[model samples]
Target chain A: MEENIKFLRSGILAPIKKWGTHWSLWPVHLVTACCGAELAHAFASGYDGERIGALNYGIARQTNLIIVEGAITRKMARVLRITWEQMPDPKFVIIMGTCGLNGGVFWNSYHLVKPFEVVPVNYFIPGCPSTPEALLRGIRQLQNEIRTGEPRSSIEFEKVDLGKGKMMPVTPKSPKKISLAPSIVVNVPRKADEETKKLADEISKLGLATTVTGKNRIALRVEKDELVDAAKKLQNFGFDHVKNVNVIDVPNEDKFIVEYHLGSYSKRELMPVVLNLFTELPRSEPKLKSLAKIFPSADYMEREMHDFFGVVFEGNEWMGRKFLLAPDTPEYPLKKDFKLEEEKYLR
Target chain B: MEALVISHQKQIGDKMLEGLISGLFKIFTSNMMNIPLIEPLVDYLMQIPLVNLLVALILWRPFFAVIILPGLVGLLIYLLWIVYWERKLTARVQWRVGPIEVARPIRGAIQALADGIRYFFQEAIIHREAHKIYYIQLPILAFIPILLPLLFIPAGNVVGIKTPYGIQLIVAFIALIPLFIVAMGWASHSRFAYIGSLREAFMYFAYEIPFIIAVVAMIYVYGSGDPYVAVEKQNIPGAVLNPLAFIVYIIAMIMATSRLPFEIPEADQEIAFGPFVEYSGILFGLVMTLLYEKLYLMALLFVILFLGGWEGFYVGILGDFCAPLVLFIKTVVVISVLVIVRSVYARYRLDQAIRLGWTSYLTLSIAALILGMFVGVLV
Candidate 1:
């Protein structure tokens, strides 16, 4: 079997085999991230990867190539490995976008794994979302490599030296610390408009302090203990669903500000309204009353917050399981204390 | 007495061998494909020893029909042509050049061959859960029902086996195709394959009745199950004579082959090729072509019933061979037109397809039966 395959692979019949393999480079459709949109663009009418014989086929068994689209969160990394392992022999992997290379904008993300760690990569296409042309060019390069047995990169990196013979520093210099997180105010005081006045008047009946944060944005803060009762009042006030769950870490205050952005889907006039319910939890305990049952839509958002903030939603059964992150992912990656290895080039 | 019996047996064996040899000569001369274009070379080749037998077997009407045109050779060429043409046509409609990079000058005409070779060389994986023997056997086994129809499909003066109930036999064979597909899905033992197999069974029930009724309607119009008699009766093409049947046949054709709007069983988006989810390498390749082969057979039957099979302007040079060529060309054209369906429509939901198959197609097929009867009486 070995001898026959060798004969087909690199012996007398290698050219024929190469020709076939080149034209039949079907990539398994395993969209890992946002780059999949651009990958779709590459395969769609505008670019048409089929013209070059790289059809985006479904199922790992039928495909011979894997085009890792972009960022692979830690959870997706496991899936990526399994899919790669399932693919038949003589398979190729092409990781597209800077996210897969060094995580790009998510460079120090707590829940991300480089695709190379999951599977052996044959090529890397760099861009946040690489252009369709770049993607096709990558396939063309792969075809050439198959025919010639030469591992050629689609791009060439030219070296640039700016120091002009100056000696290297003995110790690597540290960048000035500049955090990019926006300064968030959970309760910003503002004058109420007619709509806000109506909303505030109704919310004030609940006996909770309400503030007009912005147009269609209301901030209602309550003690952690009263969160359930305040949410029940708001639920009765016609906030149909939870739009978002947010947590702001304040290490100096030794507190975690947990907020649920609620919105109305049923009441048409209240469609534009987004009511933020804010509560402060002690950093040590970091636990809150679960609002999953209060608003059915909050169940998943609550789980995601549970994954990111390590905030235990008391009644949510999924609090312990990893929903959005890999089981092995670092705890509370979004917290202020969870510093990613300090960015050497950060300014 | 024993010595006399042994001598008599030897004599009988010798005579039997002689009769077979003489029979071959008679068969060759009597039914050879009389190609006027290649008459001189044919005559010259007939005078040779071993080569003459080959020429004789190839030119013999039944053998020619079964092994040459409208059979193995025709199927092979159609398989290659359809794959490339489908991609090219879909790309054109989608506003893109397709398959041109491989063999750039010929516009990647050999793209399928390249893929076939790659599939041949790649490993055929049998996952742990798969029923190994059945998984290995099913792809090859599925071809039996598909190829069995060719024996009954008459082309001009050449036919493999001319049964009076030819159309019915072909339909019976066509129905067997879905059974093998169902078995394949069961053998695969994968979740997607299991879902795919169940969908295949549902689709089989959905489309088979309308498709059978459509064919039966055509038979009623012709007043015979024999394709040759149907072809002879068509002074007017069946498509024009009984248009309701023609329309039903076209719709049933799409549904039967699982073309777009009806590609539910092997929906890549939903079930990842359904029954073929676990197929890899050449095994995948074999199963992939199953639908195309089914489409070819259906088109052959469709042409005989509606599109005027072998009724084109006859080529004098090709003689009896011309009919099969005409039929083959018509079937190819029919299938080429089907490529538009892929780009024009998205797949329908299972419930939607079932509703259509049960309600619309079934009602139309019944209407076609009524029309065929009225047209038959008038003619």
Candidate 2:
């Protein structure tokens, strides 16, 4: 990489190469997220990024730079790496938006991957979605970096001494760190109004462990074999559809908690109720009866849950094959015990 | 006696060599260019021996025709200007400044030069799946047809390989260029390239018939395939004589070169520059300019057939050089005007372009052909 830079800087043709590359920084259009809109505006008439000779090209093979628009998830991270590899040498990367920097709102999210980790970024335009002017300014800075062999910040900050003030300095708060082992209690009993309590009491009479978890919310626990029977009884009792199917991996407890949040669109009186039917399965062989037949909307969500936690849904045809993730992604990535490569800190 | 004989043979060889040099010099000087703008410089340079030969070769009619005006040098100038002009014009239509920061004073006039330099220095990746030999060879080889047409295309008396069938030969050579493009696609061995080459092959048939008929119509109107005779016959320009052929030829030029309205083969958005998706660095620069070079060749032929082939006002001092200058300027102007279609018009779908070419465009060319036959007899 240094050799490539050296070749661009040291030869008799260096000036021409530098000048040409400086002016012709055609960024390949890799619109990963919302920041792509801002990139468009930069090149559009408002900001006119082309005035600085940064045209947005389509293919990776032909362009010299990549303006990574926003968040790069684990799946798109591979795509970002492949695109970076496909481009010819002496390429630069300008990461746009805070999601690409350190995952802004998606910070520490299971799926979010910092684009900086996937590719060597030359510049970062820090914003929720970097503005059009900031994008063009980033391009200008890249051009300047090409002209001069150094990466200099376009705007320099003026320093003022804090020690000159007499008042005590406010200490900064420590950053939040997520717990290694999270305590997940899905069926916690809670105080509820009469209607929800009556619903919970009526659900318990059907031979299932039921608790009122909140107002208008009831949690039902059933053994793996009894789940289908419980689903059928709830279906007849006005629960018409499955709002979501989720899986929680508990490595310490050595079990997978599968939950189905059921709702009713057919019955107006039952519309406000959210019945979360859950079952626990051993980690070694986590299998469950699919609720897809009882609630048809659960079909795709069941497949997604199977993809994430490797929980086999017996009646789901889409099970046993990868779904909702790229083919090369590590299997059962959402499993708590499935370790991701930790981000390294450089001091 | 042996020594004398050897010396005598040496003298004869030297005499022959000197005679050959003088004879070649005589030929070069006899048809030398008469540019009054450079008359004093040429007169001064003629006092030197080797410089005079070099200068004579540069100004010699045939050499000048092939290497300078309306040829390689003119093509280079046209490439730079047209690329920059097209981008700038498109930017204006888009309500933006295209590339002004490169050289702020010139409004980035040398933008193409910078891009060409960058392409030249960048890595030319010959991927593993490619037909290594053909992949490397095709772009350079493609220039054969491009340059060959220049040799046969005459500008008044200054010409290379001046033949009676100059127009037909040019048309034939221009037709040969697309085969190289399709071959480039085959050598690429990628999906996009495969689709792109298939589109190119379809478009080849789509436009080539009408294009040929259009040229044939002009040939019929002129009553000869020779450019000189075609020019002499055009007391009223050929466009005025056969307007239908003129329109057909212009559309054919657009389709043949894959200009915007018919830019199906390498629609960058749909197929990622289609056949050229795999190309990078200098290889891409060469292939990218291939269509532009084709445009230049077609425009030169367009000038010869319809625009009266260098029948502009003759400058007395410029002499033989004036004709090529006029031809080149006219070709460039035609191309410059044609490039606006890129910004103004959207690309046609492959099916739409082929339908237009086969049905409506074909009909127009046939109409022009019949009109040309009538005009040929009348003239």
Winning model by TM-score: 1
Q: Model 2: number of clashes?
A: 0
Query: Which lDDT values do the candidates have, in the order given?
Result: 0.88, 0.89
Q: RMSD, model 1, all Cα superposed?
A: 4.7
TM-score of candidate 2 to 2 decimals: 0.85
lDDT (Cα, tens digit) per residue for candidate 2, span B341-370: 999999899999999989999999999999
Per-prediction DockQ: 0.63, 0.69
Tell the DockQ for candidate 1.
Answer: 0.63
B-chain TM-score, every candidate? 0.94, 0.95
- What are the clashing pairs of model 2? none
lDDT digits (tens) for residues A1-347 of candidate 1: 88877777778877777888989999985676788998889988888899888887878998899998878987788889999989888799999999999999988787777888888999888888888898889889999899888988867789976573564545455543435566457788776678877877788888989888877888899999999999988878888899899888877667889989989989986799989988998989988889998888889988998888889999988988889767798877888777677656422
Model 2 regions lying over 4 Å from their true place:
A1-9, A158-224, A229-244, A247-286, A292-299, A315-322, A326-347, B1-16
- Candidate 1 residue runs with Cα over 4 Å from true position: A164-246, A258-306, A311-323, A342-347, B1-30
Reproduced native contacts, each prediction: 0.90, 0.82
